[model samples]
Target: DKMKNKLNKQPYNTVLRREYNNLRNRITTLTRAARDDYYSEEFEINKNKPYKLWKLLNEAACRSNKKQNKEFPIEKWIDEKGKKMCTKDIANKLNNFFVNVGSELANKTQSRNPRAPTTRQRDSMFLCPITEKEVMEICKTLKINTASGIDNISASTIKNN
Candidate 1:
């Protein structure tokens, strides 16, 4: 209210400006701290209850619990050709992107040196047998609850298994 009052009675006073800034910053800090404390407390209280925890999370995120009924999987997207793309077209586009993404990424990650890997370095290429422990460690490192990659396998699946 003080900030709004200050804005309404606009004056170019250095002291008033400084006081306003201080008050604004203090409000911001206090509100942020309070919000953080509230969320932390809520999370701690619901730590043992998955359903309650998720419900709280959805509420915090302003997510609706209601399911949306739609004929198509996704809304029609306008393509560069000024045509509306259907679900099949979208799937094709995504497939093409994922198929080429690996090579594109590999090309970008290649060493900048011009005189490197002109031929297959079969002599230097050696395969080390990875143990089950190593595999499990790698699997554990995979991020949980993430979107599936081109392989269509969820990281959570591999990590859990």
Candidate 2:
């Protein structure tokens, strides 16, 4: 408070500013150390209770109260033929399936099922086209200073223009 008051009284004083910054740095360091110590103590006390351990960890991490997904990523998996597969192998399998799925679907569609109905069924169709004006209005309402995604069009440009 004294350093802060001194700095406030002489805003342009470099010595006061330096002292204030040093005082603030010391306070921040001490506070952080104390917090770490408290968290460490809590973790030690709750080591036996997994729920409380996770709760302490979440608190230390500043996580929300929402129940988080507890699913752990598969590091290694057992495949058919009793073979142990690495993450890369599992990833390749998934990738290959996804890559071929479209072609497989197309092939199946080309060779239509014999049990299919021959009638060309008709149904009511509705189409609504969003105008450029509406699109621009929405773009204008976007939050500014955000990252430009894959297309590299800036949020500032979208919001302003």
In candidate 2, where is summed lDDT lowest over 10 consecutive residues? 112-121
lDDT tens digits by residue: candidate 2, 41-155? 9989999999999888888889979888786556446898777888888889889999999999987786556676677547867679889999998887888868898999989
Looking at model 2, the pairs that clash are none
Once fitted onto the true fold, the runs of candidate 1 whose alpha carbons sit more than 4 angstroms away are 64-161
Model 2: residues with Cα > 4 Å off, grouped in runs: 66-161
Backbone clash pairs for candidate 1 read none
TM-score, per-candidate, Cα-based: 0.38, 0.39
lDDT of 2 at 133: 93
lDDT tens per residue, model 1, 1-161:
86668755977776778888888899999998998898889999989999989998997798979887756546657789887888788989989999999999998896777685466767686788999999999999999978998999999989888
**What do the candidate models score in CA lDDT, each in turn?**
0.86, 0.86
